[model samples]
Target chain A: MTTPNPTAAILIIGDEILSGRTRDANMYHLAGELTRIGIDLKESRVVSDDREAIVEAVRALSAKYTHVFTSGGIGPTHDDITADCIAAAFDRSIGVRDDAKALLTAHYEGRGVEFNDARMRMARIPEGAELIDNPVSIAPGFSVENVHVMAGVPNIFAAMVAGLLPRITGGKPLLSQSYRINRPESTVAEPLGDLAKRYPDLSMGSYPFNRDGAFGTNIVIRGQDGAMVEAALMELATLFPAEEHS
Target chain B: MTTPNPTAAILIIGDEILSGRTRDANMYHLAGELTRIGIDLKESRVVSDDREAIVEAVRALSAKYTHVFTSGGIGPTHDDITADCIAAAFDRSIGVRDDAKALLTAHYEGRGVEFNDARMRMARIPEGAELIDNPVSIAPGFSVENVHVMAGVPNIFAAMVAGLLPRITGGKPLLSQSYRINRPESTVAEPLGDLAKRYPDLSMGSYPFNRDGAFGTNIVIRGQDGAMVEAALMELATLFPAEEHS
Candidate 1:
């Protein structure tokens, strides 16, 4: 039997998401990325930028999951309190590390801008934390214990994730396949239920839809074992033989 | 001083969301709707279809928030165990109620389809629960205790929310205003910080953006009092008057 993969939880730290002023792109993007790498994303939480809230969520998620990836609250603004909260969560002291400060110092000086106190806020890191590279912007995200804290901006979050993923050793890649049956979900449930029981390890889901007054259900089968996923999909396809669309 | 609004938490129940097969729209939509009515969305969670996971999340969220809204896993399939799980969370007895079955029975009969066991599964709501109307489909969502469970489909979820929200008593309507400053967030941080401190009741956020190599920050001031939000925006405008977006 294949060993179980590491479980993860995403802590999205922001008021914009909670207030619904901004639609969350970081969680969606990170979910897909984590899945491809076989790190099971068990759950995700979105909380506001409040200090107590951030600290509580960080501690709770860190204790529950193998890894916790957080997006937002790691910028150079007074509202950006993720770094300090992370330190408080882990009971570690946080200050401006010389290395992180140097990166920002050079980035600002090269652009003919002063590395002022407001800008220097980005260089604050918790003690014993490793820096996460931010290629899009010079200010870096950091990894403290099992939690990886990153920026809230879409492009910078994506870039930091791209650079940090290679450092994480993932389990077997998750594989998936889908079949669209031109029938209502009620009609498709019988076979799909039997199919699910037949392959206990695989995950099967039936999503119903209506298109131009025609009802349809998309049955998706997902598993770590590629052969088992293909076998189940083949069995399902034979029962409801139709044009193939993957 | 205005009374604080009721707090909410969203528990999204589906493996599709956790596994990255689906991007969550319900959470984003609900966040915006709750804000308009001044039901503060404190946090949101996305969990898999596992029974224990669903039960744990429901109980935790229900205990902490004034209302806990759940979306997905209430369908005509084996994987649709949200009804049973919600019952388990509250320790309430669950079975196919006559009224719910009657709705499905009439619905299927009118469409010339049999109301089979799979379809009957949708009628299995918890004891002491009030049914929430579904306009798009005959299958009804329900509210047991403080948790309001609804369908996961975008259109149906929106429809269910449209019907369910008016029943809730909300606080004062949340008001907001924004000004886009064509300056780096670091430059805008000082004034925004002072503004936030001046109006401790209002929430001010500085969202940084890089538009075609030009740095800018959108300063948003939000509060339940329209006059307070307006006054803050005016103060901000006087400091750096360029243009108003919201």
Candidate 2:
């Protein structure tokens, strides 16, 4: 049995997110993708455009997790300083990159948009960094050490992450299954606890959800081993029978 | 005019959020609410269930922002140690509270469900903490110092936050207006930049949005004064005319 120690984390930066104007859609997509890649995402953080706060979080989480991903604040606006702050975190300087510039120029050329000074700012990369390709938007994301910096906008960031994932070293994806039991967590806690103890590798969760003014619980079982997940599912099935489809 | 330093921030705790399994819905909701309340949401962080991570985030954000609201890991599961970790951040011990016990017991009684040991675990509160009433579930969330701990689930967390907001001190609520500019950000950047400089107290944002297979931009002006918002909107209208609903 392999130890589940291959870990990853994310750091989301933006003041727009903190004030609750835009609901973040990137976290779920990243989570599902990371799980499939077999990287144990152990932590995530959201900080604003503040340089000190960004530097502190990046330094600390990078030391703890094997890989770190950040989203947002890497734009042309004055508040967009994710790249500079990351460079500071690693004690590096900010510099323009030839590869990133070429990509940005090509991207704008295809769309018939002039690559002006404000647009050129997108090509700036941290010193000694590798670019993460973005298919939707030509402006590339960058990686410094263990930290992968992606865009804040959902469409662009999601596309960028998709293009970048295969290159990273990841473990086997975790197996998870959920069943909606129309009962409170209390009704299922006893049996679920026993099942969890029996299969020590499996992580069981009971989330109580409200649907149509009635409460129900969804019990999820997750584990690295396919067989272990199957075993947990079998026990759950015995407790709550599957609904027959007509 | 006040320095407009009514500060607030959010601390989201969960491996799921960082790993990208759950895209955070709470951050945007809190940001919008705080903005309306004139609390400048300066930072947001997503940390895992690990003790040190949670402790560090709570300590840092609470110190930086006037109010720090956290969501997630307040469940009955073993990984749900938000309460304990937060208490540790404040250099306090976790213990069962008589008030929480009474509230939880009454809540379960109304639903005709017996409160077991696992259910009672939800009643654990940090020393010298006040409760944030959860309207959805009877299990109360606690606040010690300026750190307000709410559940990770969106619905429950939102309800608790709505309940807790009136109790905290807030500055003048911000007013905002948005105009859809058919042209790209480039066409508007120069004028918008000039407007931004002219209105030092207001924050003018030009967001590029995709609508009906064409790229459209929303130029938003946000500030505490309604008169400032109206003045900015008038200037922007002269630059980019509104779509006539003829």
Candidate 3:
């Protein structure tokens, strides 16, 4: 058993999200992908397109987790200050890198578009950082220290993650099994609590839902060991003795 | 003009969210509502069901923003440790409150169900805290210092926000206007940057979207002053000289 699973945190940077104008897709996508690969997504944060807030979040999350992934604010616009803020977080210098510029230059040139100053902003990278490939867009994401700064756009973000995840070392993949009880959480809380206590290694989560006036709880058991998870699920099933919904 | 709008942060506590099993609804709901009432939702964080993480987030967010709203972990289950975490963050004692217990008791009794010990856990409140009414469920949310602890369910969280927002004093409602350019963000970044600099009081946000293989940007200008926002939008229109989409 891997004693300490690799942990990660996501930092979403965009005013559009904070203003409730855009529903976040990056965090949700990253969470599922990270979990499938055995990295525990311990925390996630969404901050506006502000420099101080981004820098502060970067420093804090980077120090706390084994990996930190940031989405948004890497666009051509003036509000896209993520690159500079990330640099400040690590006390590193930032400038337009030739390799990143070459990628953007070739893509734009092939498309018969001018590589203007705004577009060139995409090439800005912190010193001593590795580039993360963006297959959808030519603008590349960068990894400085433990933090990976990627695009905010969902398609581009997804492409970058596909290229990046396999490079990072991961522990045992977390396996989860859930049982849906047709009773309210209040009915299952007591016995479920005891079941959780018995299997201290696994994580027990109860999600209550009200579906068409019928209240129910979806109890999920997560751990690295599938055998332990199966045992706990059996105990939970015996304790509840209800028809399983899932 | 309200020079500085009231700022807020949301701390969502649940393992289901971090594990990617649940898509968050409360944060999006609160963000729109807070923006409508002129409270800037500056930052939002999702932490697991760990007590240390919950306490740390509560303390950090409460100090940074004028208001902090928390969702989840207030339920009857053992993983519902948010109430205790809130108390610990502020160095206060927490226990079942009479008023809160009475509410839950009447609710369960009306439904012809027993108000068991687990159900009574919903009545836990921190010292010197005020209850936020939950019309959907009898479980009450509370506000201690600047932090407001609310439920995780979408409906309950919305109802609680409806009841809570009116009581808190708010500045002028934030007004916004958007212009959609058929061109990419790279095309609109330069002129929009100028427009933002011209009207420094207004917040300029550019959101890029790809619809049916066509890329476009929706430029939004927001501020307390409607006239300033309108003026900025007009300048933005002239700068772009294209058909407005929004």
The ten-residue window of minimal lDDT in model 2 chain A covers A237-246
Which stretches of candidate 2 lie above 4 Å from their native place?
A107-113, A239-246, B15-21, B239-246
What ranking of all candidate models by DockQ puts the best one first?
Answer: 3, 1, 2
Q: How does each model score on lDDT?
A: 0.91, 0.79, 0.91
lDDT of 1 by residue, B1-246 (tens): 778899999999888888878899999999999999989999999998899989999999999999999999999998999999999999999999999999999999999998888888989989999999998887999999899999998888999999999999898878889888988888778778887899998889989988787888988888888888999999999988775332
**Per-candidate interface DockQ score:** 0.78, 0.49, 0.82
What docking class should model 1 receive?
medium
State the TM-score for model 2: 0.89
TM-score per candidate, in order? 0.97, 0.89, 0.97
Please give, for residues A1-246, the per-residue lDDT of candidate 2 as tens digits.
646757887888865566566676776778788888898877666676679989998998899888999998776655567899989999998877888989878877888888876676678899999999877656789999999999887888888888888889888788788777887665666777777888878777666667666766777777888887988898898887766210
Model 3 lDDT tens row, B1-246: 457889999999888888888889888989999988888899999999999999989988898899999999999999999999999999999988999999998899999998998998889899899999998877899999999999998888999999999988766778999888988899889988987888888889998887877789999988989888988888888887765543
Second chain of candidate 2: TM-score?
Answer: 0.92
Model 2 lDDT per residue over B67-96, tens place? 999998887755678999988898898888
